[model samples]
Target: MSVSFPVSVRRLSAVAVAAASCVGAMALPASAAGPRHDAHRDQVAIGGVHSRSDRSLNGEWVEIRNNGRGDVNLSGWTLSDSQGHTYTFRRFWLDDRSTVRVHTGFGRDSSRDLYQNLRRAVWDERDTATLRDNRGRFIDATSWGYGRNDRSDDNRSHRNDRDDHHRDGGRRH
Candidate 1:
């Protein structure tokens, strides 16, 4: 049966169908979305930090750990500080349950440590370290020395009970 409908009615029906499709997709759990989502959510984390260093620039470091069962390619991943100083990983593969320490000063790259080759220290007493994937998606963050009343634009979204330290606190290569 062929039935003619008003233009507005046809458009409404099309919109409704599109909305329903979007809702259905959204209802699906993140796991159903695929491994990519899982990788972004739980595979990697900022394991530790050595913010203060009196000996040398290399003394300051941030450790990134791969917590998943499979090797994670961190080739294009980035680690940044609250001051916007950033370090980009270069064709590196982090093995499962392994940790890589990114140092602030110059040093030869190795399986365990990578150097930023900077003259001055990067981490501060009260600062946040943010890690992002190759596509600039937030992966994990570690913050230290901040109080509840302190506020900062850089690490606001990353605030959590575990890393609640706050203070007003970036992409420097």
Candidate 2:
């Protein structure tokens, strides 16, 4: 059901080729580019990811949520470790009310088998992942140092994390 191959330091090209070919070419172009950094703005509080009634984890899984107005195509999206070794996932659409889960595991390289990582791979749990777009742009990055937030923690949150990522708790005039 699951397979893995040890990565060779001498030659990782095979793995790279496998990943590229296996994962199609569909990434966020200008739309996926997102906005510029706000150096002067106050930080907003973000919430954790959501769970679906069909949430079944008989394998490794990554949950994606779209808090943005537009739809993002995750064809060539990649999930990488601190080492940069990545698992290329297929393109999936996350509608405004939709949440998608990617099951990882099985490829040319057995070492690349994502299921092996299990709990550690889930961004919200292990906090050990860097989500990249098809063009290789970092959608999410995490840092245990400086208390930075790139990885999504199961408990930790972002400015706009969940479906209601942007919620106004009502203002008092």
Candidate 2 residue-wise lDDT, 64-115, digit = tens: 5555544555567675544555767553544443445444433332211223
Total backbone collisions for each predicted model: 4, 12
* TM-score, per-candidate, Cα-based: 0.66, 0.39
Worst 10 residues of 2 by lDDT: 38-47
How many Å off is the CA of 131 in candidate 1? 0.3
Instruction: Tell me the TM-score of model 2.
Output: 0.39
**Steric clash pairs (candidate 1):** 84-170, 146-165, 146-166, 147-166
Report lDDT per candidate. 0.77, 0.41
lDDT per residue as tens, model 1, 61-115 = 8888888898988989998888888899999998998999999999999989999
Candidate 1 — worst ten consecutive residues by lDDT sum? 164-173
- Candidate 2 error regions (>4 Å): 1-59, 105-127, 142-173
